[model samples]
Target: MARSIFPFLLLFLFTYYYTGVQSHEEGYVTAEISNKGLEFLKDLLIEKAESSLVPLELPKIEKSVKIPIIGSVQMVLSNITIEKIHVTSSTVKTGDTGILIDVSGATANLSMNWKYSYSTWLLPISVSDKGSATVQVEGLDIGLTLSLNTLQGSLKLSLLECGCYVNNISIKLNGGASWLYQRLIDAFEGKISSSVEDAVSKKLKEAIPKLDSVLQSLPKEVSVTDIAELNVTFVDEPELSGSSLDLQINGLFYAKNEVAHSKHYHKMLKASDSCNEADKMVKISLHENVLKSASSVYFEANKMHWMVDEVPDQSLLNTAGWRFIVPQLYKKYPNRDMNLNLSVSSPPIIEVENQRISAIIPLDFVIDILDADELIPVACISMVISSSGSAEISGHALAGNLKLNDFTMSLKWSNIGDFHMHLIQTVMSTMLKTVILPFANLKLSKGLQLPVFHGYELQYAQILCTDSWIVICSDVAPVEQLRLV
Candidate 1:
């Protein structure tokens, strides 16, 4: 059962990784699964152990024994099948090198065919009897050490060491003479115990490759948008402690058509105080560079352009709306409709500091005047805006709200003659309050999907912003545990 839990835990634990999370060439993400998290694993493991221990088929065992009078009898036990299993207890512990699992007081019920034959002078012809026997395996114990690492950005699992001890294997014959019981016990007692121990250990070891194969088969990157993909490759090996394990991943946003590269080094990311608390099972930390990667990709794809031809104030799209600000605009084209072509001129520069998610966004707008029912490109304006917000866990991604701060703007060019820089600020202020800020808040509320395991989700999570990194601590439970709760 311990083995069962360890493999599944290894399967989901490090698929999404983070780190001393600095500004890497690419972005970063890391995680810490504390002892609280292991408690959830223990619950899931116990359920799996019940079904996994049965259906174990051991190799056929043949033994040669010299009986008191039968002399030189060959006994073969074939089709040794484990019909039932009971696991009393199992424990999971994190070590300096890797993880350790201990299982004790486990037992199994087995059935096999027992065939024996002996050629003796007492009997003119060789004698043989074929019958069935039931085996009771008791006082079983196993201690295992497993080595978990990242291989080519995928999770890798190896069974480093395993020790299995079985105290007793009592065999009861079904159709045989009275003397056969003691003789069979005297011949097969030690052999049965050894064989049971070996078979049980083998069963536990087989689970590693199967789970490793599952982890390796998962996709390394996920398409987040038409122009970009989320890079989810593990950046480094897990850092193990007495109580928890930390794993880091290269969480960058890669261009859809760009080639990918391997990263071998990163900061050793550890669990923060917010995540190490007893109630929160896992802690996840993300760096600011991750957001920068996304912004860069979207901007490079030329997907940040937005045409604002309609707004709450319909007059904003007409030259009359800007008549007072740009006197010549309305003088030249009276009551003409206008269109504002807005684009993010550059990637937003994001900073995580002092519990705030802040950014500087550069923007450009092209104003088109409708003359004789034909739109005419007039002039363009450039602006820089500042904003701040707090992060939240929205589904699997980090979601947050931002407020635009004070920033200066001026005209980059003008066709209607130069106007005071202060005048343009007033018009932009109205658009930001009535259109841009509210629209941005609404769009950002949905958030983007982060690089997390597809099926698993964090529950009751909390987010904290710090220097160059943000952390979230949360609890997770499988459906079985949810039903129990």
Candidate 2:
């Protein structure tokens, strides 16, 4: 009984292994956006803050006081203007809660006009003062929290030091003294501190959302061609590291209506702590199913064709005619004009085996002969060409060179004689190797380029080939002309 069951066990093992391989091949393509690469964005945010946070106007602060010497005094401060605001350092992070932006060591120059009145209850006296003072803020700290809307946020601000130098001061007293000017300066500094904090906070709350709008407006879809479109979808919330932010995105690439519907395993993505240790700024993984889907789409399009317009040499035609037992035919038409055309018989079949990608292309060849200034089709040949190659990441594109492995030809119809069948087969095989394969490689190289980011360029790309997928990893850095909009 044990011997009889041995065949069944072997069959079961084979089935299990085959199914496992198939399941692994039908997986998702993932892209990782690393943190170190996000530093460029931080710099951009700081620059934007410097330009947009300007001409800030503060609220009016009014108070009534009873002074020992100057009784029944009323003071009003308005028209506070802050300018030349500059952010020296900033830190941005993403977490489970939301996004946090902390700015430190900010400085700005401020100028404001102030007016005050003094009235003594013992005498009929009214004193008024009007002047403009300029102040220098040494260190300011701003903390902001941003939600997804980019348009909603809260800002907290504090100032470490503020010094005001009286640029111009004018005092008017109806019947009192000119010594009150110094007291006004001291009081102004005490009250202006709180006003400065409130102004900065309000300005930041307004500016943060505008920054978010700019970030959201960045282009997401990269168009490779009319038929092929790559959709980058963010699958999970971004995580923040000390130096960078990590984003998990789906690399959904398809040829119109050819996108395969598959379940996304977003839970598989884990928060990375050492994002700075990553060598590449971006990583794109492509599953084998993507190739299969694209191949099917190309086959359905049926647009693969090549035409050779040059006339065949008479000597070569004669040599072919002699082999076909039609020597006198070449003499009758020694200078016959002939051209060759090739069309796909069906869609190409792509397969991945043992770390190599291969394609089986079926083609039809038509040879037209010019007679009496009219082209007449003389021969039709059907053939299959098998090619295999290894893929590599070249610059920002997936590039590969296909080597023709096997060529086979059969004559479907030939008015040029049966022996000439061998000649046509030889010519077609040469064309496949020399002309057609190179053309296909060129198209593949140009068509598979990675999408370009606004300021970053791909560098030192590494490609990984696996049993079911290919992974491309590359570093992206700012170009010399990099600009943030």
Candidate number with greatest TM-score: 1
Instruction: Write model 1 residue lDDT over 211-317, tens digit each, in one string.
Output: 67987886778765466777877766777898887777777766897876634434334434464456788887876666666667667777767777778898988
Candidate 1: 10-residue stretch with minimal lDDT: 1-10
Most lDDT-accurate candidate? 1
Provide the overall lDDT of each model, using Cα atoms, as 2-decimal numbers.
Answer: 0.71, 0.54
List candidate 2 segments past 4 Å from native: 1-29, 121-125, 145-221, 232-277, 288-298, 310-335, 350-358, 371-380, 388-402, 410-426, 437-456, 459-470, 481-485
lDDT per residue, candidate 2, 104-148, as tens digits?
Answer: 777777776666788776668687876666667766777765543
